[model samples]
Target: MVTGVEAPLAVTRVGVVGLGLIGGSVARTLVAAGVDVVATDPDGATRAQAWDAGVRTVGSAAEVLVERPDVLVLAPPLAALPAVLAELAAELPRLVADGGPLPVLTDVGSVKAPVRAAARVAGLEDRYVGAHPMAGTEESGFAASRDDLLPGCTWAVTVAPTTAAGDLLRVLALIAGPLRGVARVVEDATHDAAVALVSHVPHVLATELLNLTTAAPARALALGLAAGSFRDGTRVARTDPRRTQAMVAGNADAVVGALRDATRHLDALADALEGGDDAAVTAFFDAADPVRAALAEAAAGDASPRTETVALGEPGWRERLVSLGAAGAVVARTGRDAITLAVPPPSPK
Candidate 1:
């Protein structure tokens, strides 16, 4: 009987088990939407912040479950997800009957496959849907949380066959109602692969760039003069180092694959430069022009969603182009069979 203008579903209560940026934002949004929100965090400061913001605070995950919320969001670090899910599974049945069970569970981890595997190991896979909301600030913690952070952003929802449809819809409703966008359903593998290319690999690359610059005395003046272009380019590198390491390590294989592909692109570019063929350079620049244009269009919200069909033809060419686009790289069709995708040139590292 949850009745409110913003409440899309009958979720009377929601539990958020980590009052960090993502958790705090979700709790605040639900509370503002007229849903009861119970939040927990091991850090007393975070809990206090949530309480100060008008959310019901709890001592632990156990107490949150005692409320038997309609949904539970595990918003811990990516590496901590396995242990958290395991702990939740152990305490779940006691809080609610097996028939109704505890609340449907989901998480805001950056990676998915590992989290899904952890849920399976914890015996809570059926009730959980892996979600990656593509929104964040460089900031972290409860103080940095914002209710409007998720609006107009794309959230990837990964579901397995065993995931409850009702539970998934309820979660989606919460997101759409308060966050103001539809959750894009994607396979766990596809979601993980795409994120590895765009988010994960870039973090590593940015860190490498920063590290190389810091190590070189010759680059001191260059680093000082680094402007909007450098700042924007290396923005993700400014993320929490520990968190970045955890994300990159947790999804090692995919990140490594992306890095290798990126290396190949760099080698090719170097070879072209060494050869000093004006025609080759011109062709490369011409092909790259469109991708740069497309990226600008995408940033300006002008790029239409083109449903390009992938048919079997060349072995690696089409896939490479598509991967470029998926990685937030600029890709444009040069001709019928030929296409060009711009790669971000390697920095010092």
Candidate 2:
């Protein structure tokens, strides 16, 4: 069972695969916090860099299982999951032959259900948990990684019907405990759908925004006049296009729904402006005031946190955590029989 203590983190050692921005950051950040960390990347230079930063290096994904980390966090790109998952499975026998239990399996993947499916294929789903730190940059590779990325970020840690409460709490202990972060215990589908609305579709729209600027007849003038708003809106388009493509493709179904919703909203706003319906325009903007306020509060980092209890000793615990996450509550501590949940202030409607 996990305790409610904070700082110096509960997870003492973590093993990571793929030393790209997210994985590299995870290894770097945990090492900075005095963790005994081991990680691997295909790029030798990346492994050397992680070693320079005080992280132990492994030669390959299968070797990570040999190290027998308490938790194995695979941080590969969306397209690379299949290969790494296979690697982990191939090493499972070697790991267990030594009379050691498999490490808690998790990943930093943006999409969830597919990862779970892949884990099942590898026969590793029994120990698999899914987690996504709601933080990243328009950058790729270890060179662009930083230790500061995950601190205070809300991790969308996932739960499934078959998940053991203890397994869920182990991942929570790492994110919410020593790492000093908060997390939502969400269902995989729920996480995919919500992130599509907030992340994937926005990436698409931002890329489109950048594309529009390039095609404009006044391109040079507009480029010269581009200000903070334009930069802020389109910054993600600056990410490696292939990486962005993989991310959006990984969550295509939800992204399609969100994209159509965006289209419908744009169509309505255009109709209102064309008809000169000032009232309709006013109502349209008013309808999103709450979303605007919520985003503002989050950006400002001013929403104070308060606590509520989530019972973990009872049946339907997975469902309970899912409901709390949907309500925007985060697990602050997973105690012996309950989770101390930190609920942020309600967004104004």
> lDDT score of model 1?
0.71
The prediction achieving the highest lDDT against the true structure is 2
> What tens digits encode model 2's per-residue C-alpha lDDT throughout 177-264?
5455668888999999999988988889999999999899999999899999999999989878887888899999999988888899
- TM-scores of all candidate predictions against the true structure: 0.79, 0.91
* Superposed Cα deviation of residue 244, candidate 2 (Å): 1.7
Model 2 accuracy (lDDT, Cα): 0.83
List of clashing residue pairs for candidate 2: 9-178
